[model samples]
Target: MGRLGRQDVAIPDRPSVGYSLLNMAPKHVVVIIPVFRDYDRARQTVAAILRCSVPSPFSVRVHVVDDGSGDGTAERLSEQFGGRIEIIGLPENLGRSAARNAGATNISADLLLFVDADCEPSDDRFLAAHLLSIREADVSMGVVEGQDDGFWHAYQQAARVRRDRLARRTFVAHFTTQNVMIDARLFNSVGGFDEAFKGYGFEDRDLAIRLARAGARFTIAPGARVIHRDTLDLAQVCRKMGEAGATTSQIFASRYPFEYRTLGYEAIDGQRHPWRGVLAKLLWPVFQPWTQHDAWLQWRLVPFKLRAGIVRIMVAVSYLRGTLRRHR
Candidate 1:
């Protein structure tokens, strides 16, 4: 590990190399995809990354780290891609962070692009864009466009965008394990991802916070886009949200005392608010431009009846849980 220094680093707007796709080959760039047991989507994600037209003159290797998926993920990956991709199958499921850490440790590449198993790049230039953007920052994050979740998903996504825009702080709105690349050394310097987060939620944001504190610069690559399929039912979504909330509370309380309230347990102030603080949370919705955008998005793209039913059930469960927690 290199000596840790804290300084504000500015990333250049453009890469040092010219815009020629043919002569841009950088062997130091490695793409890391961490997947957990979703056979079809995982394989397809791998294929998408492999087939992406990288304009950089770099030899990119795709490493797929499996987090003890019980499904036939290993068999399918091995059978399909064979020796073309590197597969690291862990003994147990350790969430997305640990899986990516395992993959990162396996390669000596200077740059590591991490994409989720369910996200596919819009085009081949995604990897190249990531590489080019690395000239100025330690990490580069791309945008996600939802695929099948329909209106509610779009609404949720818009809510996310609005939240990001409202933060006004140097926080990221879409810091998923999908469509991001980081400098291998800098990532490890901050101890990589926190393994305590077992399922989905907040781990990426947590890492980003730590990175910023550690003075790691990040660039948002607007051009590199990915199509994500977040098709979980409403019940499942609520469950995941609850898990994320609980785990995030624990992490913030333990590591960042001042920042814990920002994790959603308290308001921007130091005081802990009542459980019925939904009004405060939702009050600024109109100020968020994505709210209006999502309104149109939801109207135009409502999901099927079955999916809508699932969302209704999920919303009911979330409301009940909130009420019960407050009473307790």
Candidate 2:
């Protein structure tokens, strides 16, 4: 019935950080979802989590942080879930990392599960899987499956392959915040997510690097899966890829220089194949004729693989351009 903002909630003091699981109880879990403007998707994600039947040993609490959506997101969610879920509304858009940190700070639970508003749990056993996995591992990173098989979907699938390959050798290589369960103490100790990443990328990997440095062991919870309901068309994908490049140049490259190299910026260098950047840049002029503009390019004509390859080159050029811009 009432709206809750950032200043309204208080984060309790935490105990000293330690690696031993015995020091903390893992029964109490708080699932934090940070939403920005996407009201319908957030509602579905919350509904799916509530539908989950977590066993008695585990008590679950759901908290939705509306990051200044200004789209009646808080009102809609409150009307739907009411007292069942706690909603925290910020005065302005604080980005995903800051929003999640704010939600984490407000709850005093043994385990903190961070799930994006765009993701829906695959099954009712979603929380159960993370719970079971955390018994043996400190931080459990779950799987994210794309709901559609579009260009962005194919790109995500390929990226997942690389991530999976890396995950086999070590847990520190790739960390996505989409569906992850982490110990509250460990999360708080590592200072949650780096708020400096004010945009749409790399905050999770930055947190992973810090968590690894803090001796937190990361493991895959294959059973805990979430369906990514949000799909990006080619234009949206390009914009996101550009954002990724910009973030890497501004934050990761300077903050975590060693880990930045692992991102493989060189593999997709458009400078080597000049035409890649030239052609991608040409999209602006090529699509200008269409009144609907970017929307007109959404039609899937080329093979997904070929489109993905071209998009990758465009993303690479965007990244390099972003890096250069930051330096300037």
Candidate 3:
């Protein structure tokens, strides 16, 4: 394994690499993938990147950060790819933001492409598209195409609506770290993602907000598409939305008061809705039991429209409850 000549920093319980040598061409980029307890998916993503063909004047190095999976994810990656890819195993689960920050800290590449473990590029031109986009925009956000299922189809449809709604806005409130290419300088300028956002949700949006504030232009690079291997069942989808909704008060509300108020949540006014809270509590037991059912079975039983409606209500109520709780 060849090591780049850069400063070595220790990451507790893991081997550290020196900074990337500056001598490489300007387009030399490092693809950082952060994984937690999903070795197989990570392997596939890495393999896809390695398989992808990039045009000349652009080179790539891959670094996989195992966020304390303790599941031998690091070893499995090493066994499979050997020295072709670098694996950094954290001592404990530090969440996505921390894992990505750690990965960025180790590399000295001018351009950093952050790809989630569960996302694999759709074609060989994925990297090339992102690299080309960086010439015009500071942040090139790629689209994430999910698997062909009712849930994913519904999710995509909803996303289209939001995009249409915000089509004319200066900064559309949408950003996904699932597939994004950012200049290393711009990434560090905004201080990267907020580590405080520990769990599933607005970390990406938060970063985008900060980037926008810093005058970083974000452009869509549809050609740099990736297929997200992981898809949620009705229950999983509800749970994730609820989890994300919960963070609204702490992260979004305080940072973007205008957008927070626009979302129509009472929490923005520092008011608590006791009835909504109680209602959410009552409905919990009913929905709680359903989360355990097989996802495929849930899809089979519920029509797409009905399921979509239910999910929207669940997420909204869950978000309301979260906001109300914070105010209380």
The Cα local distance difference test for each model comes to 0.63, 0.73, 0.71
Error of 2 at 298 (Å): 8.9
TM-score of each: 0.74, 0.84, 0.83
Clashing pairs in 3: 6-19
Screening candidate 2 with a backbone cut-off below 3 angstroms (N, C-alpha, C), the clashing residue pairs are none
* TM-score of candidate 1 on Cα atoms, chains taken together: 0.74
lDDT (0-100) at residue 248 of candidate 3?
Answer: 40
Instruction: Report the lDDT tens digits of candidate 1 across residue range 111-226.
Output: 77888888888887888777777665667788777775666565556556665753443244445568888766667777988887665566786786666665555667877888
In model 2, state the lDDT of residue 182. 90
Output the better candidate (1/2) by lDDT.
Answer: 2
On a 0 to 100 scale, what is the lDDT of residue 60 in model 3?
Answer: 90
**lDDT by residue for model 3 over 134-244, one digit each (tens)?**
665667888888777656666676866665464334243446898998878768877988898986776886787666555555667879999889866656766665666
Which residues of candidate 1, in runs, are more than 4 Å off?
A: 1-26, 257-328
Q: Count the backbone clashes (under 3 Å) in each candidate.
A: 9, 0, 1
lDDT of 1: 0.63
